[model samples]
Target: MGNEHLIGYARVSTQGQNLEQQRERMLALGCTRIFEEKISGAKRDRPELLRLLDHLREGDVVAVIRLDRLARSTSDLLQIAELLRAKGAGLRSEAEPWADTTSPAGRLILTVFAGIADFERSLISERTSSGRSAAKARGVKFGPKPVLTPSQIAHASVLVNWSRTLN
Candidate 1:
């Protein structure tokens, strides 16, 4: 393989967040092509991310400012890493400094981190579900309130029912 090109991926969750710092860092690292996204990591589908993945080829190196920038959840990160591995590509994180899946030690560290991320996600889900259940027991309503007031909704319902009967 020829000299591998450093492919940088940068993301920010909000418009207010600056991509300049990330761009500067990636440029400093000799990244010729950088993919940037301004979307929440919670979102599973991101256009730029997909594009970057598609553009990656064997012997390419995917660089990110941080693991969190690549993926918010552990499983997602692992999945991305696996994709890179399958493509004969590798992952590097600037912030972590030690996260380089190209090396044995980096792989070990990533595994440990993936486990921790999974645990954290599980705990968050459990807590959210418990909180919702507790609120329900107290007769708290979930989701959006009726768009119209109760009286207006009842009127609308009656009108619809009457119209259906007429039909």
Candidate 2:
């Protein structure tokens, strides 16, 4: 450390889950501040996570027990890493030694993994688009159903015209 702080973030998916273990681990790591939340990692709107990110200062490190505890997907992890980099902060996972962004080797490894993840996402997007095109060619309809039928629209139009005539 020095003047930089090691902040911890602990999360569990459900109300029944306990955060004490994670909290104790963070304490053992000598974290100065900790943010705890009981929410699914899949959700995008996490108030505690947002607050932790907002509170980050330059040269600070965000310590997590595991990388999965922080993000559910590779893209999500990379996004958080990018944000940390932009703010001159770093991320460290105690369970995953290679995930320490403060070191040069760790940064290199993360970048390589990010490139692979991007390529995989592109392939999946292409396959999905091809499947959607095939379905459309076979007369599969998309989007919501019409709110009013043709008959209903015609009747409403007649009523409007009659009202205008009387006016």
Candidate 3:
């Protein structure tokens, strides 16, 4: 209702997805500027996202195509929302109109959903840890195979010695 600028943020987790749909939606919503990222949702250190956050001003609105586009985890979502609140900015998710942070009801709903997401993450972590422990007890190996074999190590040592002589 005020003279606030509407900004849009769109992201795709993989290379196969396109940002055209999100761009069109944000444009239809009268967004003046849009920031887009092509990265995994699990990655927290996205450059474009950080740039958009830094560019936000008081009374500005940040719109995203979906909640997952903004954050992959509850903690991340809460952190981003808190930052927006502190900056006097609002968040609007196109996928869930109830996620508009400008309204009291939307704030309450987002908080409840954040709690649920946190609980789900905890449960998943517990299950994963339990499974890993059981697998270890059964003598199963985890993680990627060692890249350097004994022969390769010896060859690397020889190379290192040769390089040291040149130095």
Candidate 4:
């Protein structure tokens, strides 16, 4: 980690949210550059995150204020780790001491976190599926409601036919 400049990443879930605190923390930690993004961690296509990944040097370290700010799930975290490892870079979180890739303990801690995140996501998915299934069984309609009723559609067709005949 010596001589490797720390690159900071700050993210917020929405436009209304503030990133000042996260940015200030990362800057205080001696981050040379920061990529601030206003997007959900659950979202896969973050442009700033992508730029940060692309801008990484072989010896650079990506620093985030919190682990959750960098990734939403364990699998996502692991994927990010793999990407950094491939690029000869590393990741660190200020809030989660165990998330520092510069040390063996941090690596182990991140691994454990990934497993937990995966499990939690799976549980949520299962519950959501069950709820949707129950709703379907209850004859609950899904998707957008019709903008025009059947009679309105029939009237529209009649008007169209009359206009076409005249033309």
Candidate 5:
């Protein structure tokens, strides 16, 4: 594909799981380079994914066996897509044709998903702010209330000292 590199990323959720199938698929799809890892999807500290993202260049393509293997959330997916797009790279998922970044429809879908993620984040922020404001207005204390007031703590310390002297 015109000196473009096809970079593949394969991931498994745990040590027990294997990457054989995913790796094989990427190889079959003509991936010239690949990154493999065994890590939980919930973890945000995937070394291989970060490396792969950073390694991509213009005209490069990132491929994965499945969409879920690529990221933990829609926001994460969108962020990866944005990064790839910024570098003039594209994304492709073997199991999800709609996620192919090389196609116009696929790009449109990703844009919509990114927009939705943004909207969802804004809504969550607004709701949390409103809730905090209401709580403060009602004189609700934040964080764990002090375990013991200053007077109570002083009394406890005095009792402990008195008991130690008797012992």
Candidate 6:
């Protein structure tokens, strides 16, 4: 698109890591603006990433050095891609050309990836449910520890009854 912007996002996992290389690469790739942050890809709350997402506009392309720099997992990548698609923006990875969302073939690949991620999630949910059911059958107790023991509860009941009798 004529009015589209090539916005860049560069991130590192820690304060000690340098963002200069990613910044320079993105700039060389013709990025109009770049958002840089030092945060782990595994972290859910990344301020600069959030800001970049919020900064996206229709026809904008988020250029990143690599897919791993953008997300830690496939599901996370899909979620971010979905957000970009919803916002009418695109995603491009310099390292992984197949990851570009602006092309038809790339979109198809992403669609297949999304389906696989969905199936994986479903399998995980089913396994968890089965495991929980089996654990319950085996008398495994789940959830928080009770605040009061049976004896404490009985004592409180007796005290309440005594107060009621007094009334």
RMSD of each: 5.2, 2.7, 6.4, 5.4, 5.0, 1.8
Candidate 4 C-alpha lDDT tens digits along 98-162: 78988899878877877887898899999999999999999999899999999999999999999
Clashing pairs in 3: none
> Which regions of candidate 4 fall more than 4 Å away from where they truly are?
111-167
Give the per-residue lDDT of model 5 (tens digit) for 1-167.
34568999999999999999988889889999999999998998999998998899898989988999998888889988999999999999988999989889999999999888889999999999999999999999899879899999999999999999999
Q: Which stretches of candidate 5 lie over 4 Å from their true place?
A: 1-3, 152-167
List of clashing residue pairs for candidate 6:
none
Alpha-carbon shift of residue 12 in model 6 (angstroms)? 1.1
Please give the distance, in angstroms, between residue 157's alpha carbon in candidate 4 and its true position after superposition. Answer: 33
Order of all candidates by TM-score, from best down to worst?
Answer: 6, 5, 2, 3, 4, 1
Q: What is the C-alpha lDDT profile of model 1 across 1-167, one tens digit per residue?
A: 13778999999999999999999999988888999999999998999999999999888889888999998767888889989989999899988867898778988988898888789889999999999999999999989977899899899999999999998
Q: Lowest summed-lDDT stretch of 10 residues in model 6?
A: 1-10
lDDT of 2 by residue, 74-97 (tens): 989999999999999999999998
TM-score of each: 0.66, 0.81, 0.67, 0.66, 0.83, 0.92
What is the lDDT for 40 in model 4? 85
Maximum-lDDT candidate: 6
For model 4 the TM-score comes to: 0.66
lDDT of 3 by residue, 65-122 (tens): 8989998876788889989999899999888889899889989988897888789989
Top model number, TM-score: 6
Model 6, which residues run further than 4 Å from truth?
Answer: 1-4
For model 2, which pairs clash? none
What would you estimate as the lDDT of candidate 3? 0.91
